[model samples]
Target: MSDANWKVAAERDLMSLGGRPRLFESGSGSYVTDDAGREHLDFLGGIAVNSLGHAHPVFVSAVAEQAAKLAHVSNLFASQPQLDLAARLKRLAGTGEDGRVFLANAGSEANETALKLARLHGNPRGKTAILSLAGAFHGRSIGALSITPKAAYQDPFAPLLPDTRTIEPTLDALEHAFAADDVAAIFIEPIQGEAGVRELPDGFLARARELTRRHDALLILDEVQTGSGRTGEWFAFQLPGMLPDGELPDAVTFAKAVGAGFPLGGLITFGRASDLFAPGMHNSTFGGNPLASHVADRVLAHVEDEGLLANVTRRGAQLREAVSALPGVSGTRGAGLLIGIALERPIAADVVAHALDGGLIVNAPAPDTIRIAPAFTVGDPEIEDFIRRFGDALNAASQSSETTA
Candidate 1:
């Protein structure tokens, strides 16, 4: 069938989220081939989920082997892979022996699990308020959405979980919110991915840590977009200067790259936070199943073994440096392989469309920001290809803007 036919069928059959999506037949490494047989460089990396890129040997092998051996045993049973992954996630989060893990199906589920933890901790003390930054994007579930603070995404689903508030991302705002002593927890993204990859103000995290600790509230860092070595660290909270030495968040939610495109997510809790969830309090039938657990564990191992974190750091710097020199570019934000290109004009959508036409894939999270979160395995070749294609796209967008003007 023709690409046009596929698109027409998609429009007819699929729900209209943002219109019909581009039809891609396959992908390998840093590129995806559309149904029309055009290969596009995948700089978005499935929104930072494809850690080793598409169809990595390690990822495929793990999935196949685990499926053949064992896939689903439900939550009632425990598997080696499940236990191993839990231990590994605890280590990665620096949660020590007191840490515990709750596996789930996606970022939304992970955040929901974190929400339950907050309730478990707060209900006894009559603390029910939940705080999130103004521009934060946690997830779309009712519980997660309540803390996300986006009007467009939340307004449609009115009467959300109560007592949720969006506050400014400032020290004073945090202080004011907690002064009431009603906040059960505060959800923060080390780097706000949906808010155009905006990082929190310097020292904001450490200060939040102090405030939450003082108020006896849980500090949950949503690392769904920045975890699994995306920020050149095991977790964003572990990044240098993100938190003081020997300091840690009460709990951390993770997904995306940890599964390397597999539908897997989890919440890791530290210290007393780990003990809050009683066994019967929460559960998922498919969570921590053998297949997803094995695959996620292997993905994390591959990222560590292949030294992809270093690659993320190095390639991120290179991509930012090259992109900054391009026409129409104002600057770049984000760390490691997750980056947001700021445009001189609010033409990021046009640039993204041009980039797609030029056989490169990117997304405009905001009017003036183009987000690029390529595979952690990207190296010089991928970087060079991206520069060449993206440069052409920028030039074309600039020319079109001039013509329109």
Candidate 2:
């Protein structure tokens, strides 16, 4: 579609993420074109979904060829592409046994499926409560939303799904949750995304694994934002340097860049715990469809063939070091592509807008923090350019605020 056609978007629907009146026309590598044909060095990578950057020949061909061949086949049927993608995911996860995959359209639905699995797993043991970490975000559906933190997002939809609880302040909350009689699952992000890239405590994931085992509760890792090589490895939890013990979660939910700009999400589980749900228990109409899974296969294959994992490791460290060295940047958080730069104050939103004007695209996941999850394929030049442009944005933010005062 042409960029001039975007004005019609406002007239058609008022959905979110449209604040910028500017429209994007096309992209190549890590750069994008606005309606006016101004080029932008994109650093956000569509908020971590565009793993390979724009117009990667591999992704374009994968989607186009699959679309021309077969786009949709109901869940009742199986397609070769879908099966192959599932096998690849299982292999990446190192699930030696037949670890089943439940494909869906997006990350939220992915979490919903995992939540349902947990419920079914606990049904036999009479477990009902779902425990989630404070500042955690799973999804928006009542089922996924029930476990998500941030009352601002949840309060409006008060009286959400029942048997859900959030914990913060201390292990007391988690302990109380674990001790509860009706506990079923513990859903948590290995590294919190919207909550300032807040990482899970050291030895805590291992502890949660132990606690869930003790209570016979299922532990679901909401890796939607952290999985699929985003964190310099196949999964953040499995990243050797990130965690002290190098722990692994029972079940993992993935979406975002796993499909590399394709709309696909998946739920993976290990051991007998994954076999909780039987046929007819849960299904997605578009689940395991050809187009999405085919692109997913290509995304994984490209990541491996191009050795993007190692690239992410090197680039992520370089980016973090640069961010930490910035004037007002206080600290850097998150592993690999999922990075958050903490500012001294709430200048993140201002910096984001300024960055847009300075030919760089970034996002403010929190008021005082700027999040950067650029494409793993983004090279050294783009990384250096990003830091240079970002420094101007930060300086502009500081200067503008001073003038307003």
Candidate 3:
């Protein structure tokens, strides 16, 4: 609220890399303003959370109106919004008749709920192992962290969930792991987020689904960063699978875009697995509350009405092509707006800082990979602006790299 408060945040309460973060006061469509009154074009879209961008009239009204009416109601009595949101998500998640939904607060919480469901579904049998892909980033919590591939985060918190295993995400590797008898679930992100937006080899998901089925393991798709039209498709796996089985993942874990920046996560389950959890098996007091549910409902409705899926397809390719043609940029990988640019020079951090300095907000998750996850509402003008500025920043970074080398 105050600069003093922002200054205090830098000193205490912030975790590592947490201090000195942007002190923003407000945001509008594809833009945010700092406490200092500096406005920056929001290309990052809160790391793929603000699908409609900050303070969209619809989103603002939804939050404001919902806040005024009923903010939160526990899971005891039925809330229409909660049920409606669940029904919408269940349908979207491909859960059809046997579908069930579980709500949580964030990506990690959602994945944790999925893990519990897997364990519960495998109740009659002993299935503990969760096979995760390499270079994965599920979330910050222990359960999700256990399956994540980044050792830098995991090494500090030694003794994560045992029976957790990692594989190369190759067909043979996945088959080998699924050959085991005790695997409860195989968790994967359709597009690995913190792992630099790496897409799994084509058909990997379909293959994993089949392998999991054969081994009685659940195929969990962690679409926290990949869902809600980020990948142009309703879900990334919808693209006809190149995998042997060509099937859908059994469970879908969604978070980032579910509530359109309101912090909602849900798990969609299919098959008889939906019956695994009974009364008190699992619950979240704040989960499926009225406010979040309303927002979730509106977000989905808005996505469809606004034709964001088609826009994501068009603009994502434009952004990718523009970045690829820029000097010092080698290539781009990823589907839709969830793109990662591979810079010829390892100046991604410098480019990010420069882009921010140039009134653009983008981030680099690795030394050479710059991620561009703009809001789905990003228009033609903003996309062009981002490319022009981003290319300039990349040029500047390249020049600096040349000087340094």
Best by TM-score: 1
* Global lDDT of each candidate: 0.92, 0.85, 0.83
lDDT digits (tens) for residues 54-170 of candidate 2: 998999999899999999979989999998998999899877675778889888998998888888878788888888888888888887888887787789888988878788724
How do all models score by TM-score? 0.98, 0.95, 0.95
For 127-226, candidate 3 gives per-residue lDDT tens digits of 7887889988888899888888787899999899778889997878877887767888888888887777888886678777777778887888889999
Candidate 2 — which pairs collide? 129-182
Q: What residue pairs clash in candidate 1, if any at all?
A: none
Off by over 4 Å in 3: 1-5, 13-17, 242-246
List the candidate 1 regions with Cα displacement exceeding 4 Å.
none
* Model 1's TM-score against the true structure: 0.98
Off by over 4 Å in 2: 1-12, 16-18, 169-172, 241-247
lDDT of residue 215 for candidate 2: 85
Instruction: At residue 238, give the lDDT of candidate 1.
Output: 89
